[model samples]
Target: MPASATKSLRVAVLADSDTRWKWGALTAQRLAPAGAGIRLDGYLLRGRATPTARQLQEVGVHADSLREVTGVEFLRAMTEESYDILVLALVGGGVQAMLHGLRHAWGTEKRPVVVTGYVGVVYEKLADGLLLRHGADLVLANSAHDADRFRAVYEGVGAEASAVTEVALPFLGGAPYEGEHDPSAEQGRRPYTVVFAAQPSVPDNRKDRAYLLDRLIGHARRHPEREVLLKLRSKPGEHTTHIEELPYQKLVQGQDPPANFRLVYGHMGEVLDRTDLLVTVSSTAALEALHRRVPTAVLTDLGVRELLGNHHFTGSGCLASWDQLDAGHRPVADEEWVARQGVAADGSYVTAFDAARARITELLDRPGPLPPLTPYYTPETAPGYLPGILARHHLGPDGAPLPGAPAADKAPGAVRQIVRRAARGAYRHGVQRVAPVIRRMGEL
Candidate 1:
């Protein structure tokens, strides 16, 4: 099939350095209809990525390159262009910045459907940004637990959830696996090799690591032959900065690791490839393990005090609460919560890149009245550099947020390419781009 260039569904993703970016990008691409005319725009916010039409070939997103335009030009494009849907994501003041763009557009034309995912206030103070004040057409609940908390605490925090959703994340899911460890594969050894991995956070915030370490250490001291692995993705700073440092150095075939204690860093994929279990607290990596059929255990350190020092909750483990500590800091699959909490009732199953594309197509094709599914992560466009910020202040100052943002953040070049290329790609896949064309190009 020949490709078309009809950017009917226009979507803008707001992403910064948050991990949610990965989930959000995957969601946008996968949810768009096959032929439902869609155009995706990405704003990197603080990172190196920029969405431009040039990259729309297979990915279907456009990066804007403001390499040459002035700050005024950037603002003009933001206000001048109209979209069908806008997904607000980002940390800190990023949502505020993007809202500036949306407000600019609203000043000139009728507003489009706006959707935003809400992270709890406990995570950060960005919950009351401009987007919320202006009112999002749709509000997103990141998790089911979050929704329940919202309702219980603030009363109205999740009040709009009926019009909102707890979106499914990047793991769009695939055929089920019985788990990577085959009891038949190893004769005289243990039935499963469990592995836990994550980037370590601050010591006070790494209770999951401490808890799991304590339990695994105790188990290892007692058993000594369980083939258990504990891997922590290291940080750039000192060990003292992290919580209860990991144990037992490396895993050797003949080496005694307590009973089952083994700790390492970096290569989680290799570890998961050979394990029957993947354990974590709230780390998303568990999803990676789950995709391959590895059973995962989420444990936070509360009572596992025998093996490590300090107790707090951070890392990626799902063990955020104290009650979970004695229960081995484990969290259930959170399946029903995962599904019903986010943007879609079926949100908890995203995994594959291809599957997400199919979902995105469907989402874009469907008209409003029915809420659009919530996005899992924030989408980012390139930051031209601090120039735009300077321009906004009319300073052209030296304290730029980036090396090249001022220039790259201005032009419409990035979105133009997405419009053209995504249209073509959709056409080839037997999908047609739909256009509401509420108002044509010059109306602004």
Candidate 2:
């Protein structure tokens, strides 16, 4: 039997009509296996979804088609359902639409949304996503980078969010990420090798990855003795399915210069262990490589600017881009660094899992009816009733707007260019959004 209901503490997982929405929902459901008595609802807003209310089939499992609701209407439902928790999945444009939809779904009846997404350079996205999170009771992040970004956005919006996780290694029953593989399988095999994880989502985004892989193949070809074991990660949904129908090991050897790249599709724990030098575009597998003491490097792209920011050591040279893929570019990560990644045999993701559990529990226990988050976002000085509107409410004191922790910058326009590029990327990848503001001087 299901757990007792706690006055309909519904968790509405919004699936904004993007494949990303499906991906995010699957991810969250996998991560948060313990909803306890809290009800879980999955609402997908396809073009013709019906907005009819049906009995939640399973106590915490609800699947519905949100008929014809814009992002705003969807958000407003928080007030309608009195949702205790609103979990926003990372479907690029879904957020802006949802916020616009919920223009009036406030008062004590609304639910808090734990909005999450990648926090790269999407300034407005980071801004808007944070604003909603600020409005919602909590925000969960997939990575530390995201957590910190949300923190800034929330603080900017006059709210605070509990840090979720830097890397979301999931647990089934509140269990640690023991990673479904055994050491005996790895201990009896391969002398030295390297595995790389590749996830190609957006078409253009994968170009850089293809280029890097090509370069690696070239480097490997030039040196035959230094066996470079390449493990390709290409599972649909789990990662990007760029090579959708490409048969596993089908891309292995004799295709062309870069054509002979290795491939593995079903799953990837043992492959990760066998890897010597983990390489990729921007997949989080490098961290796994690090934990495994496998030296790592990005194919050198602006996307990887976050991790490959600087040199690890003067002569160590653990990080590099395609431009620096010299046959001599091999860098070694010591046992200590790999241990942190859970690589040196004793390393497991258990600690991080425990920490994540604690965080979720704390968020669940926090008092509801959080202060309104309007005053911190908008600035004072040249606004009419706005300042008064923000202050008259129970909102907290104003602090500096959490100007999104810029990716990297010491000057002007650089961050803007990056953030704006990201915003454009979000739009380009089929993300629906409220129309951009038109700034011009035209005839009336």
Candidate 3:
């Protein structure tokens, strides 16, 4: 039975710097049918990969609205506050922190249900899939394919198979955002625009990005009537880690771009509307463009099996050799494939949401403590190990306290502001550089 109307369920979403806004908004809506009987709080994790205040602002979420919690604070929040569930929005990666934090926080006491959602369909080898499956109470999948993979991973490791739940990729849930730039509505008045959605730092994909951009630029130059746009992962000067990759900004700096060539930076949902044709190595944007009925192509020039396992689009019929696209062939979508992938804008995708809601309701009725950590990590020593890990990373409750020292009181005025900034910078640096090595050491 659902919690009584008099007592609302307290749900906290554990979001990283990059995902807080979307998850924050989605969790509030997804749980709305439960009405005023639920309160959703977005807590930004600030241990290793902390999201900068500026990054959160760009996501349109006010920094103040989110509760910034370190591992220590997170543990404290779980015990002190009456949260019923903690949605681990960092499922694919960074989930290890949440698992460790949970063990440290709850110790022998019951912990809130830990749920996680999938980000996409592409299978990047999850080193800790079993660990995550063991730790997470329920892992919401994006599709049947994802659910199967998730299930196989856990079942392969002799963990519980019932933990996987098929949920539509959160973005696909609810109503689609109707953007202003509809290609069909504009028709002859607007130039035919080809947009290439950029991918992250996959070395093989990054190496050929410049070549791809040049192809599009060359095509635009030859056909001056058409326009070509490179939709960047982030605009230059944005506090994004796209710098980890070869940024397109640097790639296009000295090149002579034609008048028809432009760089676009916006939500892919909006950009796809203006886009008559979309090209990408293997981006989730391909899924979006296909759903929008926009012509889309998955580039396989470098080598399909070698570069990216974009075989997820195999049925889409939009895969093209770079030479084919260079010859001005507009790739066509395979309706059969679209339906199979559930990217079709029809009501069919909603079934995933139905299953998700059903699973969530079931969990709400039977909430209890998390399982022993020994099943996933160093259960026997997690509590002891966690404090030292937190201290090493300067992730003490009040702010990175010096090792073995108590947290200092917040300094007054300018001193406080300066101190916080320096600490945050150090946190980001440690997460980017030191955390990985330390984590690997722990595994060893």
Number of the top TM-score candidate: 3
How many backbone clashes can be found in candidate 3?
A: 0
- lDDT by residue for model 1 over 1-444, one digit each (tens)? 212123556766655433334444555554454554566666544232232322223233233321223323334455567665666555423443444444433444455556555332223233343223223554444455454544343334433333334444444344443544455655644445656554434223224445545566555555444566666543221121122232223213344446456566543445665666566544545555544445555554444332321121223233343333323433334444334433232323443223334333344445544332221112222145323533442223232223343444424577865774566345323311122122233356
TM-score, every prediction: 0.51, 0.52, 0.78
Model 2 Cα shift for residue 20 (angstroms): 5.0
Q: Which digits, one per residue and each the tens of the lDDT, describe model 3 over residues 1-444?
A: 365223566677776545434554464345432443666777765533345654555445332236666544555566677666667765433465556556655677866667765555544565354454356666666566677777787777666768677665555432343433444675545777888877645333334767876777787787787778888765433334223335577678899988989887655666766677788877777877777677888887666653465766776789896578767787878877776565756667645466655555665566565454433434343455444444443444222334544222332368765876687567655644566468668979
The CA-based lDDT of model 2 is what? Answer: 0.42
Identify the leading candidate in terms of lDDT: 3
- Runs of candidate 1 with Cα error greater than 4 angstroms are 1-10, 37-39, 47-77, 80-83, 110-112, 118-134, 143-163, 172-180, 186-191, 199-275, 285-294, 303-444
| All models, RMSD in angstroms | 15.0, 12.8, 6.2
Off by over 4 Å in 2: 1-10, 15-84, 91-93, 99-103, 110-133, 141-193, 199-213, 220-260, 264-274, 291-293, 301-317, 321-330, 333-444
Cand. 2 TM to true fold: 0.52
